[model samples]
Target chain A: MAEPLFDRIALIGIGLIGSSLARVIRRERLARRIAIATRSPETLERARALGLGDAYSLDAAEAVQDADLVIVSVPVGASGSVAEQIAGTLKPGAILTDAGSTKGSVIRAMAPFVPEGVHFIPGHPIAGTEHSGPDAGFAELFEQRWCILTPLPDTDPQALARLTNFWERCGSKVDIMDAEHHDMVLAIVSHLPHIIAYNIVGTADDLETVTKSEVIKYSASGFRDFTRLAASDPTMWRDVCLHNREAILEMLARFSEDLSALRRAIRWGDGEALFALFARTRDIRRSIIEAGQEVDAPDFGRHVVAHHPQTPQPEEG
Target chain B: MAEPLFDRIALIGIGLIGSSLARVIRRERLARRIAIATRSPETLERARALGLGDAYSLDAAEAVQDADLVIVSVPVGASGSVAEQIAGTLKPGAILTDAGSTKGSVIRAMAPFVPEGVHFIPGHPIAGTEHSGPDAGFAELFEQRWCILTPLPDTDPQALARLTNFWERCGSKVDIMDAEHHDMVLAIVSHLPHIIAYNIVGTADDLETVTKSEVIKYSASGFRDFTRLAASDPTMWRDVCLHNREAILEMLARFSEDLSALRRAIRWGDGEALFALFARTRDIRRSIIEAGQEVDAPDFGRHVVAHHPQTPQPEEG
Candidate 1:
């Protein structure tokens, strides 16, 4: 109904996060013209097939030409290359940002190439599904989710406000913080969880004592929850681990130290210590639910209740 | 309308599994009379208030005096104590069973106390939620779930058949397994997942660089998945860890070994190994869904699509 927020906006990747951004931008009329680009021709064509953008390109430089905003949504490992390719092409006054999970490394990778006039802000949107690819995204991916923005010291206030406003319009609550702190926060919250999930699933897959078929059949007991995270896009997660090496390894060290203590408690039959740890963790889940970071449902409310005549199934995504 | 499967069934615990059994047994008329007992007076009172059983008691012997079946659904660590309490009072031809998560120790604990004519079967129902206690359960909890029964040698086939039928009527698919094998399978599928979840959540909570509030706020990114499993009943899980020590320790050793390799790959920026591991785990999730062990929803489909105008949210629980 009204004029779009930006005359031209370019999305440098069109996977789950990128395509979700595209869908929301298009749904809310946040951008009048959208250009999509990816390293892979097939993905670019798929993005075009999904009707995700006004224009599509295999070349990042070409995609960013004259764009009012350039959002790089590629794997964190590729940020430097994407920045290098688009450095000479990004419009003088355009806001250049990213949707990387790790802020410090992404900034380190992209900031070196940014020209003087372009605004460079690294943002991590704390939202996504395990699903990847253009077909996997919908317009509601960012709704009621947090988006953290890490701006450079000399960042233009007008540019930061505009980008903050853009994310808010896309239904995300914006939090501004230091890039290093953002990386540390995400290492614990995102990277370590993914690594632990992948590791445990890999462990189960390799166990001779437990048959793979058995693991698959009885997953509902608990293992399936980890599988959702382990099933995340390989390239995306791999890049995250590689890019956020220092913080991730630190978190991993802490995780292993704690796991060793748990192992000892179990081995020694120390039920008191184990129970205290388990009971304390329940408070965190309650806090997360109270903060609206999680839904208040048992077992994530996945199991449908068909056995009861009076009870209806709970609402789901 | 129809004769109940058992004349009187006594449940020796009033937690999630026990309460769910009580609800389903009533709904399906599997038991004409249900007697619920718990060690804790408060839990027994709560079970009575919820109408989970026809009769309630704080004494295990009093509950099982005239019952045709006695189902011990307490924490695994208390299996021996429960067996000792009910050994003298059980009816001669009654079936004595348990719904513990661990099988080998439960079998060891309860097998010695069974009366000559009574049948003793150890079962691990691969169904539950993160929630615990009487109010957290429902009739549909076991629907379409796997209920594994581990029976001793020289067991009565008639008794096993009747118990199998009881669970079948509760909407569970039954699997008969060796006690040791059941323990091994569950260590990989259930026990290890919960332990890993608890350990990771503990690790996040103890971090010096990241605030606990930040972990709670950004949990949706990945940490929330583990929080669900970590929030499980502390006494039950603590008992499980202690009772199933050998199998769990074996699984934990394997998990830590695999995690080391994964950490090495990340530290060395071995993208190929990381991508391969991540991609392979996706197939396991698909297999679990195909096997009817998991719901095929991304992010457990927790995020409802209130922000989308055209896209409808998928049917949910």
Candidate 2:
């Protein structure tokens, strides 16, 4: 195989994204050594136990010392502190990046702490499962997903190219754009969907007329799909919501506005309008499937035989 | 395997749900003979070509002649007309049921036309994929899903028991409830989730700032989950919104109210509130998985490799 891209790579925050990166880096031989760090000694120990890296450290600063590349994969809200911890320890030519969901907020929080000559590129990979922690990751997590890099204007060309090449090696195609644009795109694509999911699940939980058992029993129709997104890491989603507030609010405004019109159509019994709206969305799913972002598996390939509560339950009125 | 449940079962409407019932009936030998009917000759021909039934016709009345069980699986809006057509030909001791999504409306539309001695039960098999038409169905579509039956006050117990047995044989747990309560429960569990999904996909489709291609390219982040529900058959969902309007409207009102509160919490950067809301939803997903309502597969088992637009595209100011 080709020579390793970096002498040593430091991964700060050994969560889902961080651990996945470490696995892929090791599998693809992208780095000579992997140094993993997280704030909690318990989590650090777990990473060490998993043999996820060449070395493990609880101190973020200590992990980055002498590393040729540093990737911060914490929640967006914690990016600034992580940058501060590692800024003094970063090697002069090391490429620094983050796997945050929001670009603008991450840049605002981390840029000031990024020491001179250490390249700081902000990136958000459009990939993940609803699971978190070190064990929830896999080497194939980045396959067929987009990794977006929002490099600052003054960043060195070679550093950007190297960072792009690293993500490409990790099994993602790279797209380069401005930080502000990346945030706007993600606000609608990622943040709003998670918020809507959480809101709907909350609504179902708070229902007075329908029992919670009923919702749980009948969720396969559609509600269960939302629950997967809502089941995502709480800290990561909360940070995304707080960090990407304005864009999310704007999307929410548009969403509610559209929902009101749909409600009116339903109230007025306008089948034509409802049909048109529903029909328009079918092509989008088709397009997504064709674009390979989604599988066309019927029922999302959920053919797992369900084991359920014994039933043939009859209710006499 | 011992003996079929019915001498001859007539299926009205050969779409997704109807066709699936035919396949399952044939597979499990739930009926000695299956007769299929559709309003459109084209669809009926498609069903015949698929060899889904023992006989097929475009006449709803003719299909039900001498049938031991007749199932109307049309959209809720067409339930009344199917009931009208088959009323004159129904066998006195036969069970009459529908696989509609909305129980209350189906009961209202078909109850008045039921022959004096025939049992009229409304039910919904809480299972489906995004695809529609005869070709989109399989015998296992209802496997491990809930099939809810709402029998009228004076309905015969033997017929209800037979219908319950039929669905159970077809691989579903059976629940019995009144039509009104069924509608209320489904409004939160099924209807609202589909409406929300359609609304969000519509919102993403109409964005001025975000390119449609960009949305499709980056959809795996979270938006693609909604697209599956949004891509559901338009005619079926439109009828559902119209037929179950009251319960749906009430649910929509609740959803909007909860969303507004979530918006407020996000706007003010209430990390604690945001975390609480996000954390609260994770358990619902876990509960659904435990209830056998969802597959606990990571990324919904979406390990399909994606073919994509050639990229390494960079945008510079």
Candidate 3:
């Protein structure tokens, strides 16, 4: 068997990303020892109970001791504090990274704390379910997903290569780009979508003319798709909203402008404009499917998802 | 064996809803014969090739001859024309209904053309996959879904009851509401969601900062869900936007207002407000899942959807 890529991997904040990393690192034999740390004692104990790592500590500094790779997986808002806590402990010449959703903000938050010998390569893995916490994770969460590494200009090539190789071994296709571009790309693809979903769900919830019961009962009509994104972890999304503010605001403004045009077309009975917009969006879904970034099944394959098999009970006439 | 509810059923428009109704009506023995009609020769032939009906007709008027039930399943903008085409031939005692998404507009357009003795009931079945056309349907599409009937003030009770039974037998739980209220409910639950989805996908596509391929490659991060609704039949959505203009506009305005508040929260770093909004929306998803309107699987069960098992193959060292 090939030797593990890292002798020790210190995981700060064992939430969904951290726990999943722990599981995958163990499954792929990417690390010989996993050190899990989280602020909440309850969460740390839960990770211990799940047998997620070889060692567990409530203090992140203790977890990073002698670790070859240190991954900080906290909300983007907390990145600086987490970085501050463990900067003195991260092993010299060790690779430092993160699984944050925002790149530029996280880079800004953590860069100043990095010690001389540490190689900090910020990454954002484009993967997750609408779930959080240690138990909500599995080894397969990163499979066929993209893990984007935003390496600073001065980062060591050997460290970046080793980190990319590790992510590949753990089932992610690795992409490299600068933090600013990564932030902008994610703001459109992720941050804007989530904010729009959250906002729409709030709108639906607040309507006086439309009862909540009716909305809930008929959500499968179209509204349920947004609910999946809306049900995402509140703290994490709030952090993304704050940390990626400018890009998100820019995307939202563009979306609102486009929506105004759509509203105008509807008001004027401009069927051509409506059809043009609706017709063009289909190609993107097809491309996403072909790119292996989405499920090819129609309606996200909701009909075929096994647990919801609602075949009518045989009725005795 | 029980006798079929309708001796003959006429289906106008052989798209997703119409063809699914044909399959389910046959499977549940609700109709002894289904006479399918559509405007396009290609769609009519496709319905015929799919064996979707016992009889096929290019003319809806010809198809409705002596039928006990006539279901017009077309884009909302085309409802009145269909009603006019079939009105002269509709059997006096037959229950005439539609499967349009908007109730009020469909009622206004269709009611004036409905002949005196034929029972005219406007209904919007809260069931469908994003796929459209005859081939995209199945016998079980209506199972465990809601079928909302919007009966006009003068609609006969016996006709309403009979039509309700038909939808029920076809495996939908039926609800009755007035056209105005139904329109408002659907405007929030269905129309606004589709419009917002279309708008967001359009926004993501029109981005200068993010390339189209980048959006497609990272769509699973969030944007892909909107594409499902946006991928829906363009003609159908175009008509829906045109027909449900007022209620849809109201919902869109409300949504935009709420979005403004959310954007403020993001801009000012009001984490509590952002978290509060995000936290409250989860209950709705849970309720929808409990109401059986949504599958409880995380990520719409993308992980469990059969075709998407991109498990990493074992690698030789």
Candidate 4:
């Protein structure tokens, strides 16, 4: 429909985010040629079989060579290594970006290796599923979701605009913030939620009074929601916890403190306090729904769509 | 299509669960006459406006008079009082049931006032959305979900059979569980999850570094899932916490212990432990999906189905 955003786009570590981007780029004709690369040859083979890109390679450097755009979609911990591997081969004018969850760490890891003319923009697409791997991706993952870019102080405006344009074309609403703020924001919204989910699910899994079978059977109540987050890529979350240590720990401390207060309120049977907190949080969900950030459907219609996509979407009333 | 399950059905407490049951019963033609009673007159008026019941009243006793089936769908704390109010008026062969979240509490609270020939079956439909009130209900909320009944020893088999048949007709698979065992099972599966969600969301809302705006904006990352559970009816959850104290506290102890272990692993950077726990939880999610308990779409298809359901259920992918 329009000219390709870049002549050649290199995508490193093609997992859910990477594959989704590849699909959107292909569907929207956002790139002239695509080079898909990952450390795992099996994943590479899968990507090629899916015909996600024009070229597939295990060599990150080879994938970025002569490419106008390089998007790193690996776990946050791998960003530094991938950047190191591709820094030398990246074209002088290439724009380098990432879709890692944590921002400060990604910038620290990739900033040192960028060539003089290469635009190194750190970003995190505030979208994903518990499922991973290339096959789990779809073209519409980014639609109406936020794409946060944490640009450096001296970052080129032209490169920033181009990258923002690319993401917008791929169906994301873009926002730029400082790297530190991004990490702090995500730590509370994403990292803390995942860590807490993993913790709670682990707690339930280890319970002897209530067997795991019971937990799994009645998960629809609320426990299943935590399981989805807990089921996220362990490697990615671990890296996020470690890399975004300060912000996460800060959030964790606040969370623990607030939870202690709640525990006390419950112990004392303080209905008023509990009611106030619960009521306040209800408004937040209303805001989220009104803002179009969440759906009102039970289980978000994911189960229905996944297993019964051919079936008509059920009416609410 | 068939004879109504009950000549007249009375529902006390017109909240999310109550209203949903009313809608389902009406849709399935399970009751010829629906009489709704609630503690709050405001709620009664809302239920009337929603046309949730054929007759609306504030007096539980009056509502249950001459009714063949009376369902108390109030918070567990009010179950005893509602039972006391209606016990004298319940018809000789009427079925008295409740849709409380906690089975043991409901049974204990209402069992004392049960009339000789009337059946008091404690039931819980393991289905809901975060939203509460009459406006939040729909006829299809119970479709393909589980409705658990914890019948006391010596309970009338005929009454149980009729209630089970009614739930089945409303599109729910029914299961019978021992009251105490049901409490323990739901502690981990439902109660504990809600507690954790409320705790984490409260935690996020109280953070000094991460503003509430940030939490709401980037909630799609993972935090939003917790909000759904946290946004649940406060009175319902608070009553659950107070009524199911022992089971909830026991589960909380186990959760805290497990969390300590996870905290240790994170502190020591034990990637293996983190990875193992994370991997194990993933299987639970897979099982949930296979069990048709969870939606399979990425991020719960919240964005795609944000619009109020107007069409027939879309073909499930």
Give every prediction's interface RMSD: 2.9, 8.3, 5.8, 3.4
Give the DockQ-based CAPRI class for model 2: acceptable
Q: For residues A92-202, what per-residue lDDT tens digits would candidate 2 score against the true structure?
A: 988999999998999999999998889998888888989888988788889889999999999899999999999999999999999888888998888999999999999
Candidate number achieving the greatest DockQ relative to the actual structure = 1
lDDT (10s digit) by residue, model 2, range B57-148: 88999999999999988889999999999999999998999999998888778888998988888889998878889998888788889999
Task: Please give the fraction of native interface contacts (Cα pairs under 8 Å between A and B) kept by each candidate.
Answer: 0.84, 0.83, 0.80, 0.69
Report how far off residue A305 is in candidate 4 (Å). Answer: 6.8
The ten-residue window of minimal lDDT in model 1 chain A covers: A308-317
Models 1 onward score TM values of: 0.96, 0.96, 0.96, 0.93
Residue ranges of candidate 3 with Cα displaced over 4 Å: A304-317, B304-317
Regions of model 2 farther than 4 Å from truth: A304-317, B304-317
Query: What tens-digit string does per-residue lDDT give for candidate 3 at B13-107?
Result: 98988998888887778888999999999999999998989999899999999899999999888999998898889998899999999888888
Q: How accurate locally is residue A73 in candidate 4, as Cα lDDT from 0 to 100?
A: 98
Local accuracy of candidate 3 as per-residue lDDT tens digits, A141-235: 78788999999999999999999999999888999999989989999988988988898999988888888999999998999989999999999
Which portions of model 4 show Cα errors greater than 4 Å?
A: A298-310, A313-317, B306-317
Error of 2 at A317 (Å): 52
Clashing pairs in 1: A314-B317
Tens digit of lDDT per residue, candidate 4, span A126-225?
A: 9888878999887878878899998899999999999999999989999999989898888888887888888888777777767777777788888888
Q: Give the worst 10-residue stretch by lDDT in candidate 1 chain B.
A: B308-317
Q: What is candidate 4's lDDT per residue for B223-265, written digit by digit as tens?
A: 8888889888888888988888788877877776777676677
Return whichever of 1 and 2 wins on DockQ: 1
Restricting to chain A, the TM-score for each candidate equals 0.95, 0.95, 0.96, 0.95
